[model samples]
Target: MLVIEHIPAAIADEILVGKERDTVVMTAEERRWGRRRLRSSAGRAVALALATGTTLAPGAIIAVEPTWYLQVEAAAEPVLAVRPRRCGWFRSGRCRARSSCASWRH
Candidate 1:
């Protein structure tokens, strides 16, 4: 069934008996950090598309593929200043520091 937030589950079940979920459950605190209000340009675009009854099938598939690209860039920044070694060599290998030597001191 199509799950929606803020809408009563009973009503949603009736409307989306065999549809899909639209929202996921998150803790109140996690919601603040993990979820954000859909206010960005992309958010507005999606909202507009939905309101206008435009199809997002192909576009949604395309968007989903690149969703992790942003996360990959954010995750890779810290390593840019350091060196990468074999997976198990971190604790045993010598690494050059970017600024402070504290990381290699011990």
Candidate 2:
């Protein structure tokens, strides 16, 4: 599916009224953060590519089509959401970025 750049919030949720929709349950680790082509629970290789280095929260809309919406929902597994960081992490001297899950926290 064509990954959407603008979210439903950017437009409006009412646009989806009476429209077909599907939910893509993704493991926290699958997205963690950044743009990663993640596979949905339906086995469709849906791309969750985001440009702002933002992690998709559960219930967040990922993509939209002419007649449907691709949503992002967290899995039963622990949240492995990653944090956003600048490219100059090595130069800024703050390398401590939130990685995946509570177990990943340092």
Candidate 3:
């Protein structure tokens, strides 16, 4: 198992041009956790011990080995799409659609 304590800064595109890449798939909820164990596409175990409030974004590199790198990938999940008919009302906090507006207030 590989333990990663900190996430590296964004890697340059030129440095990753020829490297083999693998991804550690995570759900939206999983990405919010600062510490967890995940498995890469290649079945490698990765343990994260990140600092509080650290969130991993899609394509964020986790590890860079000699010839390969591991990154984070957000798994596709169903999401509710809500489009307000009046953008002005929604922005001003005076949306007339009480039912729809109340649902999101919590």
Candidate 4:
């Protein structure tokens, strides 16, 4: 699964391109300074690199791919208990976005 850790850059062209599919509602972790971390409902990582300055609402698309759309879902509880263990060398093993996961292209 991918751990998206930032708001993706917005492209006007991409907005014009249009989604060939429906909007997807994915899980989002509220990150530092209002940035967002998105994960697909199926658990794949979704990348958001745009500057959305701290107010990306739930049900909003972080970014759109040709095949899939990634959105946000606010978790009422702390996100750690819900996600799988982290994928890195940290002793805490908390859920996090590794460099590999952050490398997902828009």
lDDT over C-alpha atoms for residue 52 of model 3: 95
Q: In candidate 1, where is summed lDDT lowest over 10 consecutive residues?
A: 66-75
CA RMSD of all predictions = 14.7, 11.3, 6.5, 18.4
**Between prediction 3 and prediction 4, which has the larger TM-score?**
3
lDDT of 1 by residue, 1-106 (tens): 1111221112322443444322222233322332133232222211121222222221121111112100001111223375533333346553343334345434
- Model 1 clashing-pair count: 0
Candidate 2 clash pair list: 32-82, 80-101
Query: What are the Cα lDDT values of the candidates?
Result: 0.25, 0.63, 0.83, 0.51
Q: Model 3, range 41-100, lDDT digits (tens) per residue? A: 999898999999998888799888778889989899999998655544577667666665
Task: Pick the lDDT winner.
Answer: 3
Candidate 4 clashing pairs, residues 3+ apart or interchain? 2-45, 7-48, 7-50, 8-48, 8-49, 8-50, 9-49, 9-50
* Most TM-score-accurate candidate: 3
Scanning candidate 3 in windows of ten residues, the lowest lDDT window is 97-106
lDDT of 2 by residue, 1-106 (tens): 5555545556477877776667877666665656656566656666555667566678877666778667777778755687645443445545455243223322
Question: Model 3 off-target regions past 4 Å?
Answer: 85-106
Cα lDDT of candidate 2 equals 0.63
Q: Number of clashes in model 4?
A: 8
Candidate 1 Cα errors over 4 Å, as ranges: 1-12, 31-35, 38-106
- In model 2, the Cα lDDT at residue 86 comes to 45
Q: Write the per-residue lDDT of candidate 4 for residues 1-106, one digit (tens) a residue.
A: 4444554666465563655433335334453234334445566755545455665676555556666656556656554555335444344543244565343332
Rank by TM-score, descending? 3, 2, 4, 1
Ranking by lDDT: 3, 2, 4, 1
